[model samples]
Target: MSVEETMNYVLKIPWHDIERNLISRVQLKKIIKLRIILDKREINYPIYFYVGEKRDHVMIPYVFCSCKNFTIRVMSKKKKPSCKHLIMLRLALDKSMYREIYIDDLTLLKKIINEIIRIGLSPTLRKLLYISRNRRYERGRTDGA
Candidate 1:
């Protein structure tokens, strides 16, 4: 298999399921660092990261790195999967030395929304959400609501 596939497979294994004796913390850190370096060298995009606090545990959501390609398409009003950024983020997380953070598809959106809420931008986001929902509703309706 290709190196990317192999690394992805290794990272796909949940941290809880992995044997503690098989992988050392130091090794995990090394993996994360290497992935970050590779991502920096290859992908030229902005990455969004989120951290949350709990009583004793910290909540680190999945990473979302938006591709310049995807952003450009979005600006041009097109829909497409800019997989390069996602791949880079995955590669980084898979190889990360830290065990706390998990990268999922919703990670980026959730982080951004949470930040908006935190900064009291809820009203604006709510309006946008409402407009989006209404647009979908109108599209589905036989008569305009």
Candidate 2:
């Protein structure tokens, strides 16, 4: 299969079910299996699989997560998106968003940040951009940030 096709297949594999049923039941075994699959495909870096809102979601390093992991990481880095963690998070979040999860508009800003990170932009530039944009919404922001 083409790379794109393979990726689609992998992403569609009912991660939520696996997380809920399989993960806790056989944590080590499932992780080993997942590691083998990722390794065979040469997918480096950590890929977090978890259940969110009863749906399975994968949090790659640079991807955004509704679970707040990405936001926490970015905020900890002072809005910087330089780390590999951020990059993977972006990739994972983009994929998830494309799957039609009804994400709130409040998370749109973080999505933009994820895109910027994916494009190889410098972290300093990203931080500056985030600050500028954040100011625009500061007055009436209800995003619970």
Candidate 3:
């Protein structure tokens, strides 16, 4: 998407479910199946998914990815910024978000995913966890408390 198009999506007409990527100017549909597998031991699993009318697709190895946008825009040496997938990859490596995954370690990713499955993931549970941890702030428990 071009800068002008992105701006229109963000300003002129807003998408209800659109979320601002903390690290980029793009508004991406919620990323699903936060999966990461590298090295020979990685298991067959679902990774990043596109949220659109079509069915979800799997994330191929970066080099092998169709990468139409990047190939068209970057390979020919355009002046635009990188694509969303590349931006996502850079975010994953930044150590700022997605603290659950170990960007450099496959073993850690496996362990985290297994734990999430075992404990279960739910919006209510997540909200409850947040509230419980920030009880002091949420309920105004200040120094006087």
Candidate 4:
């Protein structure tokens, strides 16, 4: 029998691990940064990041980021796995542990509601969560490549 390696689906991550390892340290040095930029009017505001002052946005669900490492390492032919920014987002939404600072702000709630009104809740979330492939392939092409 031949042994084959299989890829794991990482669409969902366990929330507890992220909080325990990552979120608990946000207030420590202030060098590693992750900010959900929600206006009092809209939830679509970008996520601001600062890893050694290099800024990026970690678009959730699909886990896309603007950091150079993500662009060159993950997006540009060199297929690497997830980065710390993606993991940060995964752990950002803690349910039972500490309060997520972004969501705790009442202004952010109004923005989320306004965003939901603009696009409807389901569609907005779908757009946020859809893991789209690069444009090199055809739109509907699916052959299990």
The order of the candidates by TM-score, greatest first, is 4, 3, 1, 2
State the lDDT of candidate 2 residue by residue for 1-145, as single tens digits: 3334334434454554334443332332211101312323543334443322223333443333333443454445335333333333333454442121111242443453354445423243334334645766785576555
lDDT of 4 at 40: 52
TM for every model, in the order presented, reads: 0.24, 0.19, 0.28, 0.37
C-alpha lDDT values of all predictions = 0.36, 0.36, 0.38, 0.39
Cα RMSD, model 3: 12.2
Where does candidate 2 stray beyond 4 Å?
1-33, 36-42, 60-64, 68-145
**Model 3, 18-131: lDDT tens per residue?**
335534422332233343445635454434432223222223212211245654764456543444554443343332332221133655444444433454333332343345
Q: Kindly list the per-residue Cα lDDT of model 4 for residues 1-145, writing each as its tens digit.
A: 0011101223355555555546654333212222344455434443433232223232433355555565676667456665555555444433222122233254544454455344333232223223322322445565444
lDDT of 2 at 66: 34
Q: Once superposed on the true structure, which residue ranges of model 3 sit more than 4 Å away at CA?
A: 1-65, 96-145
